[model samples]
Target: MNETIQTILNRRSIRAYESRQIDEHELQEILLAGEYAPTAMGQQPWHFTVLQNPDLIEKLQTLCKASFLNSDNASLREIATREDFQVFYNAPTLVIISGNSKAIAPLQDCVLSMANMLLAATSLGIGSCWVHSPMMVYGSADGAASLSNIGIDFPKGYEPYAAAVFGYSAQPLPKAGPRNSDTVTMIR
Candidate 1:
């Protein structure tokens, strides 16, 4: 298989990460890849917020945990109760993608951008996991205030759609699980 295909197959949602941050050059490449993702009507109505400060990441994690604890979803509450739980898996870098609310398909555009970034990170031998807690937390009024207090200011009319963490893996990559055979159908 070609390198791109190999990279896609090898990519996994990494949950544990080393303390060291990813290289700046590699991060730039990943963000560039995100920028190139397909957008609705070429609006490219998305904003990338990269958070590398450890203090800020810790604060965001705390906020996410608190939000999760208050969630009605038992799964979220259970996860939040874990003593070792870290919303971003303790990754050194977090990237939040926000989309213009007026765009044709803001959520889809932002999600595609995130997918590109994840693939790019995997190609660079970096681990990445799409963490949804940020979006969940940021959607609430309290969470919005907390995010603002921490200096995360999205462009006016833009709302966060996706968030992910990137870093070097602390453990060996796990083997891919078996694929579900009935999920796709060929129209031709």
Candidate 2:
């Protein structure tokens, strides 16, 4: 199989990470990969906010958990209060992908960029996980204030669509699960 194909096949969402941070060059490469992702109508309406400060990461996780607990969703509140939960999985870096609120297919564009970043991280032997709780938290007023404090700014109408954590794996990741072929359809 081709190298790119192999990378895609082997990619996994890593939850446990070492305390060490990824190299600056590797992080740059991953960001560049996201920047090069194809967008609808060539409109790259996404902003990637990379946070490497451990203090900020901890603060964000705390804010996110608190926001989750305040939500009306009972399940989310329960999960947020769990002892084992860390929104960013203790990774040394967090990348928040936000999109222009008025752009066509902004969410899709952000997702494509995140996918590219994930693949790039995999190819570089870096562990990464897609995080959705930040998106949930950022939608709230207090979360917006926290983001502003952390220097994550969005244009008046922009919003966070996705987030990810990156670092070196602390343990070997589990194997990929069996594919569900039934989810696909063919017309040919």
Candidate 3:
């Protein structure tokens, strides 16, 4: 199998991270990989915000943690507002993927790009994760001021799409398992 396919098959979402930061070049390359993802109508109407500032990263973490911790849902509150909860899972960098809220299908495009970036990061020996849980706040201005502080327009019209955290992993990478037969469909 080719390396790209291998990367995809082998990729696993990392939730834990070490204390070190990824190099600026690697971060740029990962975002570049995301940019290459195909978009509907070629709108490319998405914005990529990379968080490299440690202080900012910490502040955002606190905000995310607070948001989750304050939720009324007992289960959700258990995850988000818990004393031990860390919004970014303590990862060193955050890549916020957002797009024109008005785009015909912004969520689909954003997810595709995020998937591309995740695969790219895996191939490069960088730790990464999809972070499906945080999209709840990223699209909300009251929720995502951290993105705005970095100069990314938190579009009241721009829907927050998805997010991925990148860094060096603190543990062994997991192996990909076989796909369940029930999950696949082939049409000719």
Tens-place lDDT per residue, model 3, 1-188, is: 99878888888988789979988898889889889889989988788877767787676666566656566667767776456777677788888888897887888899999999998888889989877544655534466565466444555667668888999999788766777778867897
Clash count, one per candidate: 0, 0, 2
For each candidate, the alpha-carbon lDDT, in order, equals: 0.93, 0.90, 0.77
Candidate 2 achieves a global lDDT of 0.90
Q: What TM-score would every model get versus the actual structure?
A: 0.97, 0.93, 0.86
Model 1 TM-score, all chains together:
0.97
Comparing 2 with 3 on TM-score, the higher-scoring candidate is 2
Candidate 1 lDDT tens digits, 1-188: 99999999999999999999899999999999999999999999999999999999998888898889888899999998998998888899999999999999999999999999999999999999999988988876687778999888899999999999999999789899999889988899
lDDT at position 170, candidate 2: 89
Candidate 2, poorest ten consecutive residues by summed lDDT: 147-156
